[model samples]
Target: MGGDFGPRVTVPAAIDALRRHPSLRILLVGRQEQIDPLLSHCTSIELDRLAVVHADSVVAMDEKPALALRRRKDSSMYLALQAVADGRAHACVSAGNTGALMVLGRGILQTLPGIDRPAITSAVPTVNGHCYMLDLGANVDCTASHLLQFAIMGSVMVRAVENIDRPRVGLLNIGAEEIKGNEQVRLASRLLAEQKQLNYVGFVEGDGVFSGRADLVVCDGFVGNIALKSSEGLARLISRKLRRSFGLNLYRRLLALLARPVLQELQAQLDPGRRNGASLLGLQGIVVKSHGGANRSCFGYALDQAVSEAQMNVPERISEQLELDLQSRDGSVKTF
Candidate 1:
């Protein structure tokens, strides 16, 4: 059990997923008593496709990662990931403590060969469609090397998941000029440029993220997290203003009715629930981290993401790409 609503939300989401994908199976890893009650209404077919693995405890949302790693080995989050590592599950999805999940995921699944650490990446809506951005909250402090690694993984992910032939990679910076960013970004820019494997499109500003100027934007978690949150806040502000403007008077209300179809389509296009899962890339196994406050529909989207990643064998693809890149180089690329 994890997240704000725990099994109450996740159980229904899992049931709904089972309904949608006839071949899908789910392992509900949590306290048996808490999880079982939520499943009482599941159909026989849904019950047949789902199993509950008991977890001794639950990790608190605010628990320190290190402490949870050391003391809460039997927590639901840990057990779910362990299932993946043990080959009992193809992927693990969690809406628990992000820090704890990252720590536990890296420790249990291990990083892919040549990857220093796992970076959190997700698809962000762009003018063209969407692009993946990484280091969302995984590595707040990163070296130039780390940024380069993120770029490689993010590019590979987009190519595999989005089916882009050669995705354009951009380094997030204050300006498009090579001379703008600090030492780390500039160095990372040079590294990315040298890699013929990557389609480096030079520096991208904050606004360039949504402009669809690049297929992937690479940065340390500190910058990426702030940018993501700011974008979310701006979206909420614009939505609120639109609603207020539409209800200002009878004339405005009439206008809103006429514009309802267009507004509905726009809302659907920008729904956060449609893109709920954040992939922890570079891990040896698939692990999708869902937002902790997610409702049933949003959690269902996270489950769908996990299924997609598992089917694509994302970890293996990244590993193969990195190996090819390493051998193609003149002994310059780093591996851990």
Candidate 2:
């Protein structure tokens, strides 16, 4: 109900996911009138695995998080999160107001033990498969401790979801040197390096993120958000420039025709839709945030991400890892 296309996109995407995963069950939390019309498009088999829990109101895309939490208690986003908090669903996926989702998710699900706040994490395509980056905009300002927490959680997430036994973690910094970056980053790097459990690979510059220098990159939300958005904008700019270049002349047109398959493969590899879901890690329950403007296929990818995380038991894994780390330290380390 909160995405750009609302039920028109989500309903179909949910059905598509159900078809892909036969054991998957979906509880569509939205107004019946709006959701029922879309249900007609689903097959009988698809309908059997789907259920609609009526939520008469919706939190608008631009709505303030505080207002959504205070006034929109009956909203689809609220109920969907409540379902996860209530254990009725393993995870909640929403292409809704991101701020609202973060606020509501933290309020409902609560943070895992030793975690002060949840970080928004997502897989960024790299020269080598992909790398997970965290604090994508959950907390604009963070202390060194927060960054350390993100590194620990991100390492656990990548290891569980990507099947890396000892995922390498890096601090996103302006330069590779220990003398570079702000005081917060320098402190975070020192803290990360001290952790024997993590494969702390020191600082990784902006370009190193896609270079696959590390399996997980950690930073404060302000820096992480800027980096993520800048990469997205650059991807779009490059794609547009390539399309224009291919259409400039007859020779170029012919060249483009000859290179069509290769270009298509490259585009598919770089497509943001293929990596649409960003997990709100550190929370006790699973919540995946999709791009608000995502189409049905993109939304389906977000649903797939949710399913994957749920299957991996990511939150539990993180909690257990933290507990083990704390015990190993003889409870001297701070929980934040």
Cα RMSDs, all models: 1.8, 1.5
Predicted candidate 2 versus true structure: per-residue lDDT over 1-336, tens digit per residue: 867899899999999999999899999999999999889978898889999999979999889998888998899999999999999999999999999999999888999999999999988999968898888989998999999899999998888888899999999999998899999999999889888999999999999999999999999998999999999899899989999999999999999999999999998998878989999999999999998889999999999999988999999999998888788778866645
**Residue 218 error, candidate 1, Å:** 1.0
Name the best candidate (by lDDT). Answer: 2
Question: For each candidate, what TM-score against the reference?
Answer: 0.94, 0.96
Give candidate 2's TM-score: 0.96
TM-score of 1: 0.94
Worst 10 residues of 2 by lDDT: 327-336
* After superposition, candidate 1 runs with Cα above 4 Å error: 330-336
Angstrom error at residue 270, model 1: 1.5
lDDT, model 1: 0.91
How far does residue 178 in candidate 2 sit from its true spot (Å)?
Answer: 1.7
